[model samples]
Target: MRGRTLNDAFIILDEAQNTTIAQMKMFLTRIGFRSKTVVTGDVSQVDLPKDTKSGLIDCLEFVDKIKGVKISNFDSSDVVRHRIVRDIINAYDKRKK
Candidate 1:
């Protein structure tokens, strides 16, 4: 993942919240011509060290103003797991506020 470029490929990076700022930048730069990349993460569920900044959150801030970048936000209603999962997410979200 260091020096290779992904060309004409579809790349998906899951759990992006676990990545560091520098890692996200490196991953994004690997995209080459005709490549489509998707990064998915739940900022609320980040597992990085407490002092570390989440790359997903950082990327969102910078890419929001860039052209050809689209961001989609989903709530607990989007949870497709067991019904209890959605309830749990909603409970935690409520507690956060």
Candidate 2:
């Protein structure tokens, strides 16, 4: 995803919370004509070094205002996995606050 542009492609970057700022920018800029990109991450679960900022969080700060860019947020209620998964997420969320 460095120098090549993705054309007519569907790219999904999962676990993006681990990406550094520069890596996120590079992944986003790789989008080309007729391509759709989806970046998924849980900010609370970011595994970057303490001093490193998460790219997904940084991108969300500005992408909402960009045309054709859609941001969808889902809570525990939207979890499609087993019930335990949603419960786990809820527990973590509660602890964060």
- Per-model TM values vs. the true structure: 0.95, 0.91
> Which parts of model 2 have CA positions greater than 4 angstroms off?
none
Pairs of residues at least 3 apart in sequence or in different chains that clash in candidate 1? none
Task: Give the best candidate by TM-score.
Answer: 1
How do the residues 3-97 of candidate 1 rate in per-residue lDDT, one tens digit apiece? 99999999999999999999999999899989999999999989999999999989988898888788899999998999999999989988989
Error of 1 at 79 (Å): 1.0
Assess the local accuracy of residue 71 in candidate 1 as a C-alpha lDDT between 0 and 100.
89
Q: Flag regions of model 1 displaced more than 4 Å.
A: none
Instruction: Tell me the lDDT of candidate 1.
Output: 0.93
Write candidate 2's Cα lDDT for 24-47 as tens digits: 999999999999988898888898
